[model samples]
Target chain A: MDINTVNSLSYEDFVQVFGNVVEKCPLISAAVWSRRPFTGLSDIEANIAEFIDSLPRSGQEGILRCHPDLAGKDLQSGTLTRESNEEQSQAGMTALDSVEISRMRHLNSEYKKRFGFPFVICARMNDKEAILRQLSERLTNERETELERAIDEVKKICRLRLYNLVLSDTQNKL
Target chain B: MDINTVNSLSYEDFVQVFGNVVEKCPLISAAVWSRRPFTGLSDIEANIAEFIDSLPRSGQEGILRCHPDLAGKDLQSGTLTRESNEEQSQAGMTALDSVEISRMRHLNSEYKKRFGFPFVICARMNDKEAILRQLSERLTNERETELERAIDEVKKICRLRLYNLVLSDTQNKL
Candidate 1:
């Protein structure tokens, strides 16, 4: 979307457009959308600033909601857009050797059994080996601590997404 | 504990010590812990590496367990260990600004009413304002997505806690 068009979009329309990007990642979309009224926000920085300023208290939780479970490969690819999925695969898991993949699967099961949820991590910028190493290490964390750590990772993911959104918007303008 | 002490500790002991830190911030702790047996690793790089590695998974449902809806400000303060209190505080309502605090209370009520759990986030490393911003933005997400996000956030928190433990150990060694 063009800067002018994005800036001029009605709140609902804006939601519809950007919301699609965020649909699979609803928390991210809501985070971006909740902070709205992008008028005079031609540049990405201004848009982010406005978006941040416009965020509602209730929406933070929504932003936090969209993260996927760590080592869970079953989620619909739509949950992450093509771009994000590609980035994630490239950065975090594409190079996983069979041994690491098996370890990840075993850890994933154990983690889920203990915590009742899949392990979750923000996989945007990390490489495969680093993620595999993490999977092995975090297995020892008690349920109480591991759960909270996952959420913090989600926050980082949101921030990274926001940055990516702005960067993409800038690229689109160019 | 010192590196020698940490080295001497069994995996269970390591989990006990590092697990406490993971409870505070899982992503950070997990990231750090994954790189353990730190004989050759430098301190700062080890910490940074852990932080990088502790990100949440790409796409999966997350855990969601909130602290008690409302407790006396000091109820857990002296009773629990300092670190435990801090971990609770990361989820507790005290640190939020008035608006966010109230909204959290309100939404917490609604969420509890709906899902039988208090609104939870892995709040290590975030300030009241940023947290508030996220809270407001996330309210718009669907219930399922929000639940997933909450769990993801929790995992990230655990990883951070893991990272901290490693750093603390390295410091003790030095």
Candidate 2:
């Protein structure tokens, strides 16, 4: 759909379509619906980011917590939201071997223990190697720094999702 | 959580926990947040049912469309939403052998072709034998009757989900 079409959506339709642009956090999209007449997809992205920035630490962590871990049990169990599953699969997360899977699980658990949220990178932006390297590197950062970095990655994921919704070559069947 | 705890949730937390009570239709939970301070779980369920009944036919169909097909590709590939995956598995959908799977796929597609939505049953309320019987029986139903039947099933599914959220012996960690 075009920006004009997006601009014309009712609150329900907009939320139904763009709701998962921020992973499982539809509340972000539902809240952003009030800021409508978005000039374009970027305007929508900006509004989403602004909302995320305005949240308290707990709320922001809730957003990160909403994300399924890369190569985690959700992936194994096939319960990742569609957006997350595709992104992880594209990043070769679905191809990880036994050792890599165990290592990722250990790292993911440790990271959550430290930060109280999952290690969320934009899986569409990084391959599995880059994701593994970053996971290890970021585990050493201060909590505040990691929080900012993780939310930035969320925006990247959000941007791509917005593109898929607003700039798709064909109409979104959803 | 108890009804008191449930009644105390902010719009975001309420949606986060009870959102999937209607499957992919978090918009329902988002909308229902306006009607909060629910007297108890049954009141919450009543409000949900009322909100659903208030929808136009198209909107009602939209709710049915949000459900995944029983024993379809989502189940086969492990991509069903967590609630749906579990419900389907419990109904023995996950255990369907090759022939049962093929028969289900045929009936599911045919149902969708006729009704413009997947055949939705409360999988937790039916075993495979009953589901198969109902699918065939319901397919012969008129469009309006089928729509009502399908939506009634959605409510049954929704009721169990509400119980899971509100009446669980332990506090919901979500």
Candidate 1 regions exceeding 4 Å error are A1-7, A20-28, A31-34, A38-72, A75-80, A171-174, B1-174
Best by TM-score: 2
Query: Candidate 1 lDDT, tens digit per residue, B2-98?
Result: 5666555533344346534422222232234434566632452455333423322211211122132332233325554455466557655455556
Each model's chain A TM-score: 0.62, 0.95
Q: Model 2, stretches more than 4 Å misplaced?
A: A1-174, B170-174
Which one is best on DockQ? Answer: 2
Residue A17 CA displacement from its true place in model 2, Å? 8.3
Give the TM-score, chain B only, in order for the candidates: 0.54, 0.96
DockQ, candidate no. 1: 0.02
Alpha-carbon local distance difference test for all models: 0.47, 0.81
lDDT at residue A66 of model 2 (Cα atoms): 69
Interface RMSD values, listed in order for every candidate: 13.5, 10.0
Candidate 2 C-alpha lDDT tens digits along A1-174: 767778777554676798799877665675676566887777888988987786545456656766777998788899888888889999999999888888899998889778767899999889989999999999999999999999999999999988876667576422
- Report how far residue B73 has shifted in candidate 2, in Å: 0.6
True contacts kept of each: 0.00, 0.00
